[model samples]
Target: MAPRTYGGLAFIAEVYLGSPSIRQYLHVDTGSNLTWTQCFPSSHSFVDHIYPKYSPEDSNTYFDAECETTAKNSTPKFTYYASTGVCSYELTYGDGNLIRGRLAEEMITLQTRNGEFKVVYDVYFGCNDQAVGNQYIGTGILGLGTGKFSIVEKLGSKFSICFGLIMESKPTHNLILGDGANIQGHPTVINTTQGNYMIMLEFILVGAELKALDDPVQVHLDTGTTICHLSGFLFNFIV
Candidate 1:
């Protein structure tokens, strides 16, 4: 078997839905699962170009949330907008990107040690003119991490999560999960102030040196954020 590459994340794949198509990328997120993308009706949102737009008429997997028949084995809801009206299955990201759609089935491609694999899943995706311009950093988000409503809950199973960050200055950095790998050993077991949540980070290391912070920094496993963020103070100090 190929060496299992470890990344620090809750979900594994970078998957998203598009107009009449499905796109996949290496995604990083925390607590969300309404997979969608930017499309047809352009607007000033995140990077309103990477997301996909699905056409129900042409796509066999697409369905409308209003149709009662679409509710069979799926949840149908409407997304309300002050500017737009009620949208089916409205979705919002921590980064402020909003999507609207209903539950529909689609085939997804995933990478395995062997090769690419496929699975058909019922998902809520975005459609309409406003989402047309959502193309951004990653193709879309794979929402199967530890959360109240993660894809794993729907899938009803335990899954792995990992991510590799681009350490611009540092020559090496590693992200570990469950049982950590020893490449970045002696990781400080940082305490999370949050009572009980999967987002509590165990450590913040600087090339094997765990930097101690005065306050127990709140670190959450956010799936929606495309890149890791640090406050201005932390960023300056880290660099």
Candidate 2:
């Protein structure tokens, strides 16, 4: 995990997509599913591309994700229309930016720790053409969220993230996926609610005192977001 903050976002990893493999830098986000990259011939209102756009015509690995009988389970992050018979998607970000595109599968290449590249085929992603936002400087998002098409879910592997000391000038953080993931300490059951990683946070420890909350709060764990949101009632009670 090469975690450097830019545009108030943390962690951008170098990734390659397609058959021949075009290089791209993706923002590592766990808060949302539906991995997407900007494509060429976008709408006029689409976000300006600082990096080159992803062209499906250039990749032999590209395959369109077809229709499901029902629009409901078609895709967790996509909006389905029977007339098209193709998986099209629309995603909204926290900052009110919405992106629209078609869903497709392609080969993805990742750099290993030894600096060797590993190619994983048939990875689902959105080849987005329209978006509304200032557009953070990057290719797109590498979603680690719990949704069906997310990189983690598609790989069907357990992943782990290790954080370094806060005061360290150059923190040595690590993100391990599949067999290399190490999560052997204490274990807590994780529950998924609408692609959110939910865990019951029953108590809070301040100094030597352990204080129990009146009501157990369900916390969502997300590496994508840097801030936490609480209900007004919960905020007042905690304060």
What TM-score against the true fold does each predicted structure earn?
0.51, 0.81
Pick out the ten consecutive residues of candidate 2 with the lowest summed lDDT: 67-76
Angstrom error of the Cα, residue 14, model 2: value is: 2.1
Task: Estimate every model's Cα lDDT from 0 to 1.
Answer: 0.43, 0.72
User: Compared with the true structure, what per-residue lDDT tens digits does model 1 show for residues 53-76?
Assistant: 434465555544334323332322
Q: Any runs in candidate 2 off by more than 4 Å, and if so which?
A: 1-8, 44-52, 69-71, 74-86, 135-137, 165-171, 184-186, 205-211
Candidate 2 global lDDT:
0.72
The per-residue C-alpha lDDT of model 1 at residue 201 equals: 43
lDDT of 2 by residue, 107-200 (tens): 9998776778778888888888777777444667788887567888666556777766534666566666566677767898888887778899
Best by lDDT: 2
Model 1 residue 83 lDDT? Answer: 58
